[model samples]
Target: MKVERQKDEIVVRFSAGKNASKIQSILDYLRYEELTSKSKATQKDLDLLLKETKRGRFDKIIIEMGLDEKDYR
Candidate 1:
């Protein structure tokens, strides 16, 4: 996992490693939450996120948010 800051947005990168399913689930949950507030997430919103995750771009979000790996255990 790795993190980087880019202007107003933070960048996250993760390899998915051995916990790809878990990671994807968590991402789905987050997306759900974000969409919940707006009632729904458009296809474009999901597509962009999926594209980034496919490229391993979530480490920064984890790092910036300071998620503990053990916490997921």
Candidate 2:
């Protein structure tokens, strides 16, 4: 693999023989890093978001299964 910077962009060059899925996975991680580099979110905000997401999923599952809140308690 060869990486170079030309003008304002960084270019990556690789052989076609390389695994496509592996290359895609690396690109995905790089994209995530590039996107999050400018983010102002804190760990606390992430934790709260995760908590709410889990609670929403759990509530949906409970309702779908015909289960009451006290049943799980």
Candidate 3:
């Protein structure tokens, strides 16, 4: 395997006998990093967003199951 920096991008050259699944997982991570690199949100913002989303889903589940709100609260 060989790696080089080409302009603002990276070029990785692997011989034919590479593990495809590991390469795919690495590519997926790089794609995620690229997608979030310009984000302005903080960790606190993500935590609150996750909390609210979880609460909303739980609220929906409780209504569907006809469970008492007091039981969950």
Give a tens-digit lDDT track for model 3, residues 8-71.
Answer: 9999987766597798899899999999999999999999999999999999999999999889
Task: After superposing candidate 2 on the true structure, give the runs of residues whose Cα lies further than 4 Å from its correct spot.
Answer: 2-6
Which lDDT values do the candidates have, in the order given? 0.77, 0.93, 0.93
Model 2 TM: 0.79
Find the candidate with the highest TM-score and give its number.
Answer: 2
lDDT of 2 by residue, 1-73 (tens): 8999999999999998759889999999999999999999999999999999999999889999999978775
Tell me which of candidates 1 and 2 scores higher on lDDT.
Answer: 2
Poorest 10 consecutive residues by lDDT, candidate 1: 54-63
Full ranking by lDDT: 3, 2, 1
Question: Which sections of candidate 1 miss by over 4 Å?
Answer: 40-73
Q: Model 1, 1-73: lDDT tens per residue?
A: 8889999876679985898898889889988786788656698998998988854645655667889845543
Comparing 1 and 3 by lDDT, which wins? 3
User: Alpha-carbon error at 16 in model 2, in Å?
Assistant: 2.1
In model 1, state the lDDT of residue 1. Answer: 85
